[model samples]
Target chain A: EAEVAQSPRYKITEKSQAVAFWCDPISGHATLYWYRQILGQGPELLVQFQDESVVDDSQLPKDRFSAERLKGVDSTLKIQPAELGDSAMYLCATTQGSNNEQFFGPGTRLTVL
Target chain B: AQRVTQPEKLLSVFKGAPVELKCNYSYSGSPELFWYVQYSRQRLQLLLRHISRESIKGFTADLNKGETSFHLKKPFAQEEDSAMYYCALMPGSGGSNYKLTFGKGTLLTVNP
Candidate 1:
């Protein structure tokens, strides 16, 4: 079975440093999502993308965080000047554009020291 | 606005026991509900969706429109059933821009 792929399974960075995570959604999926899950909490939507175009980024912290899908296939999420509170699990999910359900990838665990 | 609620933070049960994970939602429009589970050392995956109305791994959830709830229930729990369960809500009917709002998850621990 094909599954979503994520890079840098675990990352530890000093406060105010830079960190990046990557995700490749299932083929043929047009809608991709980025979410953050702090310890003891459920995942929260950070951004949503539809074929390289951002659909929703209302919850993404623009000043320090950025994401892009250059070819509308794989995506990258970056956090510059990471803060201590930025420690969390970054999850990437995707849907078939016309479907309500989604498939999730193994998350990248970030630890901002 | 759409919201999902999983009231129980943790539920402990023994093997071969009945298990029920509570989930409720608040949405003005027609909503699509789903249950996602994350087992230890595993990625989060969809356990079931309301639209499918199919029982999976001895688990079932019924969408109650009047009550605004879609709770997951299993008649006989197994040791592997221990995992973190999340209830999600998507209120929009339009396929485009479908965003999922997830609830605080419930951790079910099935003891041996």
Candidate 2:
């Protein structure tokens, strides 16, 4: 069974440092999503990508966060000057088509000290 | 706007006992409901969807549109069935941009 791939399973960074997380969605998936799961909370949507274009980023903290999927396949999420509040498990998910079931990656746990 | 609610934060059941996880949603348009589960050290995966109308691993969920509920039920729970369950709602635009809203999640523990 093919699964979504994520890099840097765990990351530790000093406050105000920059960090990046990568995600490769399952093959043939067109829609990708980035979510942040804080301790004891459900995953919260940060951004949504329809192919290579961003569809929704209302919840994303644009001041310090950015994401891109240039080829409309894999994606990268970067956080500049990370803060203590940025520590969370970042999860990436993808769907085959619209309204389809989402497959999630193992996630990258970030710890901003 | 769409929202999902899982009332219980944790539920405990013994082996061979029946289990039910409560889920409710609020959406104006037609909604697609789903249940996602995450076992320890494993990625979150879909347990079932309302549209499929299929039972999986002795679990089933019926979409009650009138009541806006999609509770998951499983008979004869096993120890291995312990995990965190989340209820999700897909209320995004069509074609693409299918953003999903998830609930806080309910942790199920089945003891022997």
Candidate 3:
């Protein structure tokens, strides 16, 4: 089975630094999602993408965070001036359609000092 | 806005014992319910969805529209069943804009 691929399984950075996470969805998957999972809490949706277009980003902190999937096959999420609270697991998921089940990646664990 | 709530943060049960994880939701419109499980050192995966109504790994969940609950249940639990489980909900009507809203997961420990 083809799974979502994420780079830099673990990252350590200091506050006020910039960080980026990359994700490649399963081939042909049209919808991609980025989520943040804090310790002791479930994953929360940060952004959703339909093909190369953003469908929802209400929860994303636009001032500090930005995500793009230019080709609609891969995506990058960047956080400028990372904060202490940003230390969490960044997860990428993809689905073939709007109502299909999502497949999640191994996730990138971010640690900000 | 839709919200999912899993009341118990932790649940423990001996092997072969019955197990149930409570999940409740507050949504004005119809919604789709799902249960996702994450094993130790594993990525989060879908265990079951209410729309499918299928039992997976001896676990089943029923959507109670009247009570607004979608609780996961299993008659007997095994040690390998220990994992973190999350209940999620998505808007039922929205075409492609629907996003999953998850609850604070329940950590289940099935002891021997």
* Model number with the top DockQ: 2
Model 3 chain B lowest lDDT segment of ten: B90-99
lDDT of 2 at A49: 92
Model 1 segments beyond 4 Å from truth? none
**TM-scores for chain B, in order?**
0.97, 0.96, 0.98
Instruction: Give candidate 2 regions above 4 Å deviation.
Output: none
Residue-level lDDT for A48 in candidate 2: 95
lDDT of 2 by residue, B1-112 (tens): 8889999999999999999999999999889888999998899999998889999999999999999999999989999899999999986345576778899999999999
What is the TM-score of each predicted model, taking all chains together?
Answer: 0.97, 0.96, 0.98
Q: Over the full model, what C-alpha lDDT does candidate 2 score relative to the true structure?
A: 0.93
Error of 2 at B12 (Å): 0.4
Candidate 3 at A70: error in angstroms?
0.6
How does chain A of every candidate compare to the true chain A by TM-score? 0.98, 0.98, 0.98
Better of 2 and 3 by TM-score: 3
lDDT (Cα, tens digit) per residue for candidate 1, span B4-75: 999999999999999999999999998989999999999999999988999999999999999999999999
Interface RMSD, one decimal, each candidate: 0.8, 0.8, 1.0
Candidate 3, residues B1-112, lDDT tens digits: the string is: 7899999999999999999999999999999999999999999999999989899999999999999999999999999999999999988886887588999999999999
lDDT of 1 by residue, A1-113 (tens): 98999999999999999999999999999999999999988899999999999999999999999999989999999999899999999999999967777899999999998
